[model samples]
Target: MAAEQRKLLEQLMGADQLIGTGAQGRNAQLSITDNKVCRSYLVGTCPHDLFTNTKQDLGPCSKVHSEGLKTEYETASSAEKAKWGFDFDYMRDMQKYIDDCDRRIDTAQRRLEKTPDEIRQTNNLLKQIADLNSTINTGLLEVSVLGETGSVAMAMNEMHKVRTAKHQKETAERDLKNLQDTSGPSGHQKLQVCDVCGAYLSRLDNDRRLADHFFGKMHMGYSDMRKTWKKLSVELKGRAPPVRHHEEEDPYSAGPRSGRNQRYGGSGGGSGGYRRRGRW
Candidate 1:
């Protein structure tokens, strides 16, 4: 976390480019080609942040996230930003990402809705609970009546029946409670999407699993994006002319950029040692 902060600070201040390295003893100019300046960060969130240490963990963004570049992009004249194309590319990428997540969420929600088979199962389970309770009550009533009549053997036999029924009732109640998961007011374990990450989750999930999801990188990354995208989109629309879809090429890369960022994730860089490749 600290390393990320330091890297961000350096990029923001242009310190890495200014202090130890410069062309002809002058500070290097900031441009789209500088991978150190994340184009996505200029307008909104970067994709690399969406997952970390998760099944879908995305490693450190291939491009750097720098407040300095964002500020530069922000303060530039409308024409300047238009020429840079950073804002447009970011929005384009982000919209597609957001749309895809929305689709997934919709699909998950539909899947989570109770089907006829599941509903019938739940109803059957409820009936079992009710029948077990009724048996337990009836046995208890009989035991009480026999005990009052001084029939000790009969009362004892009735008490045993009640105990067995009581045990069955307890198990049935537990299952019922589990089925009535708190994911929704509905009486079933309806899956819910984690608002922070758009991933499907269930209230029936263990506390530890839920904690891991909330604290995990992908979820937090989406949190960061959620906070930024809508505001950024509004700001861009008001401030600059809209970009068309014809230009699919990323203006930042002179040619195709390597998918270096995808190589590093929870596996610690694919055992090929991204660090050994001197990427870090």
Candidate 2:
């Protein structure tokens, strides 16, 4: 790169010349050949002859007074023409270089715009929470019964109450864990103010429930945000989220929530990392 810069600088100097050579001979041709000069009057070098009269058809002509004056004149003319051609080529190259740079800058700016921001991440989390809330609410009703006054109905009602309480606790815990995960040691943690309910819940479970009560439609809109962010960062930046936890341990780590963790109605290690959602 440094050497290329130097070469370009050299071209800028007057030492570099653009010369014209014949297509047939590849040799510099002079307008004032021996035949032409012999026919002309012998005279001391004059500016008019040196600069203009000596050449025809834009030929290389020399003005230098020296023993090799004739040869020098031809060589200098060719060099000058070559330099002009080189300059024209250089200007064209410079324009192309600038155009390429502009394209690169535009591409970079688009990528930056698509990059995830704190507000987007937060909105995404809230949507996930709303989904979870809906699931819990539906599950509660599915397992519950309403009936006229009766012994069996009362027993069923008691069971339904127990089930509902259990469900709420489990969902709340999942929401809490999600909140901690996003807000913990991970520097990328981000959450946005809740637009629907005007109240915020960092936990997934809580956020979902709140969204359900406030802005149900808008909440799920961001369900794909996490996946989207992961995809964009991987494809564009060539980086991934930090692997902060080991797969075998750390009950708090994200994966498929399942097994003993589910039975206990708590967040803990399982076959897969994510805990299975259940009524606590």
Candidate 3:
């Protein structure tokens, strides 16, 4: 039983290498053969036989001297000692280590068996959350852009109203300052003009004209154009347009009659005018 156990232990420790005498002895033979070949070529050999038992003049065994020894005594001695002095502690440690390794291997196998199911569950949950988050984000962006369900039109109208009020306040202040700066023959009426063309207003018709112009076709037309263009520009630019608290109407005449009519005369009649155009 002890021998069998020792055989098993040696097998575990690579018995093929530890138990062998084949390659080592063969290599020693090759060294001796090489030395002998070299000596035979370099020096002429004696014809006489070199072996003597008792009393005779003996010549050198050139083959033995030149080729050196085929067998190694010291090496054989060490092999014998190593074979005798086998360690029980090392064997016991190796057995313990192998036992621990087997336990770890079993645990790893169990973990691997459960991993695929757990991974599938985790992936499913992650996919569900990802889809839910995407839907929610889409809804929120739609509400923010096109406004809410019940109040979409209202929200747009309210925003336009606020923007218009702010613009009127600014224009009024500029007109007040211009009036303060210089004197003119039209008295206080020098301020009344087509805000678009800067043409002077001479009558109530012109005043009505300007008011109609202010809250009329140009306003609605420009607002519609802005809705389309602003959407396009914002998508391209990847950011919101800049905000100014108040903006003035374009002082420089906005192109020609052709330019104004082309943009302003689409489908919906515009109530708000070119004054509605904001900064980029």
- What's the lDDT of the predicted structure labeled candidate 2? 0.33
Q: Which residue pairs in candidate 1 collide?
A: 50-218, 51-218, 52-218
Candidates in order, TM-scores: namely 0.46, 0.19, 0.22
In the range 1-280, model 3's lDDT, one tens digit per residue, is 8655644544464332323343454433433223222221112221112112212223333332222331221234644423321111112212232233335434433432324544465455555545545554554555566665667876566556545544554555555445433333233343343333223344335567657655654333323333433333333232211121222211112334343233222422222222321111
State the displacement of the C-alpha of residue 123, model 1, in Å, after optimal TM-score superposition.
3.4
lDDT tens digits, residues 1-280, model 1?
9667755656576543533353442323555445456678676666765654566655566565555667777788977766665654565455555556666655665665767766776798899988988898888889889999999999998899889888988887887677666323353354566644567676678989888878877776665655455555555543432333334445443533233223221221222110111110
| Pairwise TM-score winner, candidates 1 and 3 | 1
Q: In terms of lDDT, which candidate is strongest?
A: 1
Clashing pairs in 3: 216-271, 217-270, 218-272, 218-273, 219-272, 219-273, 220-270, 220-271, 220-272, 221-270
The most accurate candidate by TM-score is 1
Per model, how many backbone clashes are there? 3, 19, 10
Score candidate 1 by TM-score against the native.
0.46
Name the Cα RMSD for model 3. 46.4
